[model samples]
Target: MPAGLVALALGGFGIGLTEFVIAGLLPQVSRGLAVSEVAAGWLISGYALTVAVGAIAVTAATARLPRKPVLVGLVVLFVIGNLLSAVAPNYPVMLLGRVVAALCHGTFFGLGSLVARRLVPPERASRAVAVMFAGLTVSNVLGVPFGALVGERWGWRATFWAITGIGVIAAAAIATLVPYWAGEVPAGGRAGKVPAGDRTDSLRAQVSAFRSTQVWLTLAATALGYGGMFGAFSYLAYTFTEVTGFSSTDVAWLLVVYGAGLVAGNMAGGRGADHNRDLTLIVSLAGLTATLIAFGLLASSPAASVVLVFLTGVFGFASVPGMITRVTDHAHGVPLAAGANVSASNIGNALGAWLGGLAISAGLGYTAPLYVGAGIVLLGLAVMTYAAVRQAHARETHSSPNSARSPDRKASM
Candidate 1:
C-alpha cells in the first residue's frame, strides 16, 4: 500500500470521529446547554443534512479540481467546525459548527474514493478504497469510544478540541505525505471508441448526474437503506440500557462489539464488491434488513441482544463499499457523481432517523425503528433489483437482430 492511501484513511478517521462523537456526549451537551434532550438530537440531524447537501453540491463544483487542495481544504473546514463547536456558548452556534464541518464531509469521501481508485492498479482499486474507509470503520471501533471518554473525564468542549486537533493532524498527513495526484480519467476508461454508432461511454457525458433516473433510484435506495439502519442504531444505546436491562457501562462495550462487526463487514464488502458488485449489494441489503428485524425481536434478551447487535453491524456495514462501487461502476468517468452518491448515503441517514423517530413518537415501541430500518433497506433492494433487471433486459433487447440493424438507434439496457 502507498503512503497516500494511509493519509486518506487518516482523513477519513478524523471525519468519522467528528461525525459520530456527538452521539456519545449528547446528554452532557444537553445538560450543559440547557436544552431538551430532543433538541440536542438536532446536532445529529443538522450535521447529517448539511453533509448530504454539501456532498452532492461540493463534489460537482470541485469535480474538475486537483485532489490534494480539495482534501486539505476539507480538513481545514472540519477543524474549524469542531473548534467552533468546542467554544459555542449557545446551541444554535454549536449547530452552525456542525453544518460547517458537514459541508466538507461528503466531498472529501467522494474525492477520496476517486483518489483511492487512481492510486493503485485496477484490480487493487477495491482494496485501496477499503483501506481508506478503514478509517471510517475504525472510528466506530475507536474514535467514538475514545471521544466519549474524553468528554466524560474532561468536558464536552474538550472532546471537540481533541477532534479538532485530530483534524489538523489528518490534514498534515494528507498534505505532507499523500502524493499529489491530479484528478484524471481512470485507467481502462473510454476505450474501444464509439463502436458502430454506439456511444456507451459518451452517453450524456455532460448531463447532471443527479438528474439521471438510475442515479436518482440509486440515491433513493441509498438514503432509505442507510436511514433504516442508523435510525434504530441511533437508539441502540437506549434500547440496550432500558429494554435489555443492561448496565449503562455495558452498552458501551456492546457498541464496541458492534464496531468490530462494522470493521469485519467493511472488509468483507470491499473484497466481495471486487468480484461481483451487484451480487454483494443484493446480499448485503437483504442481510441488513433481516438482521435489523432479528435484532428488534431478540434484543429483549441480553445474550440475544449482543448476538443480534453484532450481526446487525456486520450485515449493515457490509454494504458500504459495494453501494459506492456499484454507483461508480455505472458512472465510469463521472467521478463527481460517484461522490454525490456518498452524499446520498447520508441523506438516507437523515430520512431514516426522522422516519424512525416518527414511529417512536407515535407511541410505537422502541423496536419500531428496527422494523422501519428493515423496511427502508428492503426498499433499496427493490429499487436496485429493478435497476439490475432493467439493465439485463435492456442488454438483451439491444443485442437482438432488428435493433442491431437499425443504424440511428443507440444501444441501451
Candidate 2:
C-alpha cells in the first residue's frame, strides 16, 4: 500500500472521531454550555444533516479541481471546525462548529474512495477502499472510547482540542503525501492536465453517471441495507439496558465488542468483494438479516445478546465495501455518484432511526428495532437480487443474434 493511503486513513480517523466522540460527551457539553440534553443532541443530528447535503454539494463544486488539494482543503476546514467547537461559549456556537466540521464528512469519503481506488490495481480497488474505512472502524473501537476518557478526565472541550489537532495532522499528511494525480484521470489521456471539457461539461459528465439504472438500484440497496442496521443500532442502549439486562458501563464494553466485529468484517468483506462482488453482497446481507432476527428474538439472554451483538456488527458492516464498490462500478467511477451514495447512506441512517423510534413509541419493546431492521435488510436483499438478475438478463440479450442487430438495445444494468 502507498503512504498516501495511510494519510487518507488518518484523515478518515479524525473525521470519524469528530462525528462519534460527541455522543459520549453530550452530557458534559450540555452542562458546560447550560443547554438541555435534547438541544445538545442536535449537535449530532445537525452534523449528520450537513454531511448529507455537503457530501453532494461540496463534491460537485470541486469536481473540476485537483483531488489532492481538495482533500487538503477539506481537512483544513475540519481543523477550523473543531477549533471553534473547542472554544465555543454557547450552545449555538458549538452547533455551528459541528455543522462546519460535518460539511467535509460525506465529500471526504466520497472523494477519498475514488483516490483510494486509483492508488492501487483495479483488482484491489475494494480492498483499498476498505483500508480507508478501516480508520472509521478504528475510531469506533479505540478513538471514541479514548476521546470520552479524555473528556471525563479533563473536559469535553479537551476532547475537541485533541480532535482539532488530529485534523491538522491529517491535513498536513494529505498535503505532503498524496500524489497530485490521484483521482485526476483526464480525457486527453494525460496524468496532470484537466479533463478535456468546459466546467459545465465536466460537471454534466459526472452527473450523467446517474443515468444508469444499475447505479440507482445500487444506491437504493445501499440505503435500505445500511439503514436496517443503523435503525437497530440507534436504540441499542435501550435494548441492552431494558431488555438484555446490561448495566450502562457494560453497554460501553459491549459496543467495543461490536466495533471489533466492524474492523474484522470490513477487512474480510473487502477481500471477498474483490474476488466476487455480487456473491459477497448477497451473503453479507443475508447474514445481517438473520442476525437481526436472532438478536431480536433472543435479546433476553445475556450470552445470546453478547454473541448476537458482535454478529450484528459483523454482518451489518460486511456489506459496506461491496455496496460502495458496486455503486462506483455501476457509475463508472464518477465522483458525483460516490457522493450520492454517501448521501443515500446518511438518509438511510436517519430513516432507520426514525422508524425504530416509532416502533418503541408504539409500545413495542426495545427489541422492536431489531425486527424492523431485519425486515428492511430483507427488502434490500430482494432489490440486490433483482438488480443482479436484470444485469444478467441484459448481458444475455446483448449477446443474442436478434438483439445484436437491434439499434435500441438498452445499456447493461
Candidate 3:
C-alpha cells in the first residue's frame, strides 16, 4: 500500500473523531455553553444536515479544481472549525464551528474515494476505500473514548483543541504527500486507469447524472439498505437494556464489540466487492435482513443477542463498498455522483433513526425496530433486483443483431 493512503486515513480519523465525540460531550457542552440539553443536541443534527448539503454542493463546486489542492483546503477548513470550537464563547458560536467542520465531511469522502481508487490497481479499488474507511471505524472504537476522556479530565474545549492539532497534521500530510495527478490516468493508459473525463463544474452536468435509471436505483437501495441496518443500531442501547436485559455498563462493552465487527466487515466487504460487486451486495443485505429479524425474535436470549449485534455490524457495513461502486459505475465515473451517494447515505441515517423512533413511540416493544429495519432492507433487495433486470435488458439490447446494424452503433465501434 502507498504511504499516501495512510495520510488520507489519518484525515478521515480526525473527521470521524469530531463527528462521534460530540455525542459523548453533549452534557459538558450544554453546561459550558449555558444552554438546555435540547439546544446542545442541535450540534449533531446540524452537523448531519450540513454534511448532506456540502457533499453535493462542495464536490460540484470543486469539480474543475485540482484534487490535491482541494483536499488540502478541506483539511484547513476542518482545522479552523475545530479551533473555533475550542475557543467558542457561546452556544451559537459552538454550533457555527460544528457546521463549518461538517461542510467538508461528504465532499472529502467522495473525492477521497476517487483519489484512493486511482492510487492503486483497478482490482484494488475497493480495498483502497476500505483502508480509508478503516480510520472511521477506528475513530468510533478508539478516538471517541479517548476524546471523551480528555473532555472529562481537562475540558470539552480541550478535546476540540486536540482535534484541531490532528487536523493540522492531516493537512500537512495531504499537502506534502498526495500527488497532483493522484487520480489522473497517464498517457498510453499505462496506469490501467480510466481518465476522469471532462470537468463537471456546471450544475447542469451534475444534475444530468440523475437522469440515469441506475443512479436512481442505486440511491434508493442505499437509502433503504443502509437505513434499515442503522435503524436497528440507533436503538441498540434500548434493545440491550429492555429486551436483552443487559445493564447500562454492559452496553458500552457490547458496543465496542459491535464496532470491532464493523472494522472487520468493512475490510472484508472491500475485498469481496473487488471480486464480485453484485454477489457481495446481495449476500450482505440478505444476511443483514435475516440477522435483524432473528435478533428481534430472540431478544430474550442474552447470548444470542450479543452475537447478533456483532453480526448486525458486520452485515450492515459490508454493503458499503458495493453500493459505492454501483453508483459510480452507473454515473460514468462522475465524482459528484459519488458525493451525492454519500448524501444519500446520510439521508438513510436520518430515515432509519426516525423510523426506529416511530416504532418505539407506537408503544411497540424495543424489538419492534429490528422488525421494521428488516422490512426496509427487504425493500432494498427488491430495488437491487430491479436494477439487475434493467442492466441485463440494456446489455442485451446493445448486443442484439439489429442494434449492431444501426449506423450510430457502427460509427462508434
Taken over the whole model, the C-alpha lDDT of each candidate is: 0.79, 0.87, 0.84
RMSD to the native, candidate 3? 3.4
| Candidate 2 lDDT over residue span 294-388, tens digit each | 99999999999999999988888888888888887776666788889899999999999999999999999899999999999999999988887
Task: Give the lDDT ranking, best first.
Answer: 2, 3, 1
Per-residue error for 345 in candidate 3, Å, reads 0.5
- Candidate 2: worst-modelled 10 consecutive residues by lDDT: 186-195
Estimated TM-score per prediction? 0.88, 0.95, 0.92
Candidate 1 segments whose C-alpha is farther than 4 A from its true place:
31-39, 185-189, 192-212, 396-413
**Per-candidate clashes, comma-separated:** 3, 0, 0
Q: lDDT, candidate 2, residue 232?
A: 96
How many Å off is the CA of 9 in candidate 2? 0.6
Best by TM-score: 2
- Whose TM-score is higher: candidate 2's or candidate 3's? 2
User: What lDDT, from 0 to 1, does candidate 3 have?
Assistant: 0.84
lDDT of 3 by residue, 85-168 (tens): 999999888999999999889988888887888888989888888888888877877765776789999999999999999999
